[model samples]
Target: MASNRRAFLAATAVAALAAAPASAAPADPLETTARPRPTTARAALAELLAGNRRYATGGSRHPDEGLLHRHALAAGQHPFAVVIGCIDSRVPPELVFDQGLGDLICIRTAGQVLDEAVLASIQYGVQELHVPLVLVLGHERCGAVAATLDHLRTGAPVPGHLELLVDEIAPAALRTRHLPGDWAEHTMRANTVWVRDAIRADSAFAAATVTAARFDLDTGLISVLP
Candidate 1:
């Protein structure tokens, strides 16, 4: 049954893909925004991965940014996934995933830290928007992780409200200290896992598939972690 469901989803995604070029000058305008959305979490993840492949290989279609599509989306948004990521300027989720207007609901913080507001926003996406997937995206050599590591080691005060951000990421920095190799990278991965787990544990949020991933800056590739 699972395989059959996957096959059906693959066909639906193909139908959606074929409709992409028409979005350049969509006849109905809203038609582009109405493509068959991934019905399951695995299918949604696959779509995101496919988009990332296009982005990494320099073959992005840059779908759904057209003026007509923008106008159509003014009526409503039905994004497929909720991306929880870091505030790093380099890793814009839309660009990295090659998705466009109304395709993803994104919430970003330094180290992808979760607080009440972030959790609430994500909950709204899953419960109200019925988004199938929630991805916590971390990246290589994350600045937040590095800062937390340094601040924790030195016991120096971080300036301004930035201390709150570092403090949120402190657990990952401390947890990965015993691991070999680069501290920041390990902490970043650990932090993504922690955030993913936290979201899963949150009773307030509606049911959705939660996952963690890492993005490599040099390669422009994103990988889902085990």
Candidate 2:
């Protein structure tokens, strides 16, 4: 069932991408102001979850992509949420959540690993931009977490800066070793939770809410973890 869902989503993504125009000429700009931003974490999270439901059910409205929206965003962006997700080509936050321009502050890293720079970027979003919510989004079949599991089991050396990813993810892999499920999947969820907790613990992010979620590659659904 899961595999079938995954195949369906993959086909859907391909069809959508193929049907989309290569480029669109800018539409006449509308004289409009930016929409009101979500001021509370709960409100921000509700907006994201609603968008995800639209995407999962194939009812995406593709809002905020018009020329007026783009032009308004050029002045300044007040994204309501900060999404920390994997750098997977297939799991773009915008498309997955069905959000458009200036709706989210997206930060992607392999395995959703956090370093000084990633942390700083998230901090900026929460503190400077006053983004109300931060989402740590992990997905099924993450190559980075899988590689870390491989390295742990085989004691193999990963060459170059890629090893850094393995190193950061190793702790999550180790922590979840005793759990009764697929190692990679477990590690993915664990990593997401770990990062969420880390962000919540950070002093700079105290004003914002931090949460973790797993993206089902098969169904294109995002399940928020408790």
Candidate 3:
């Protein structure tokens, strides 16, 4: 009985020693791969969707603004894309896309309307920073779209510079006026397409960056309407 007890203790010790290396060894290289490299359009789009899933599923990898990372990024930034979107509080581009700092260049307009200044900003992103993609994200039941529609359909006088915004967004609303049901919703989507086309039309960079950018809205997916 004494001999058997001693052997059991020795076996247990050996087992623990054997398990130590397994625990101490670093993870598999493939299992712990570095951040993905997105050079191509498909690769870029896939990454955006993957991040969006994390956003929608509440597993967001929030912006990493730690001291080390911030110091590293102080020199310059290489934002992956630019998002031209509405100014709605809930529709923040970073939160919706689950992107971290230095990930995106964002521009906000009341109705995502494009004019000279807006075009210049976009041109800088394209001509200078060489951002790989541009997303025009509009949302469901957008207040700006609703306001524009009201102004066009009823000739209501919207206050201040809002009148100019309405004028810019009026064409889409007018085009969809004769549609049967859900005209506002349809026009909202149309407005998104309009902005996308306006960007493409306004800049030579648009043609140069063809098949690299996309436009979509908050429909649970990043639809690429290039």
lDDT of 2 by residue, 1-226 (tens): 9999999999999898888885653443332434566789999888888899999999987878877677777999889899999999989999888888989999999999999999999999988998889999999999999889989999988989999999899999999999997988889998899999998999999989999999999999999987
Q: Model 2 Cα displacement at 84 (Å)?
A: 0.3
True-structure RMSD, every candidate: 14.1, 12.7, 7.3
> What are the runs in model 1 whose C-alpha is more than 4 Å off?
1-34
Model 3 lDDT vs. the true structure?
A: 0.71
What overall lDDT, based on C-alpha atoms, would model 1 receive against the true structure?
0.89
Query: Cα lDDT of all candidates, in order?
Result: 0.89, 0.89, 0.71
The TM-score of predicted model 1 comes to 0.84
Q: Which scores higher on TM-score, 1 or 3? A: 1
Candidate 2 — which residues are off by over 4 angstroms? 1-36
- lDDT string for model 1 (123-218, tens) is 999999999899999999788888888898889999998888898888888888989998888889888999999898887554799999999999
The TM-score, computed over Cα atoms with residue i paired to residue i, of candidate 2 is 0.84
Models 1 onward score TM values of 0.84, 0.84, 0.76
Candidate 1 positional error at 205, Å: 2.9
> What order do candidates take by lDDT, descending?
2, 1, 3
Displacement of the residue 9 alpha carbon in candidate 1, Å:
55
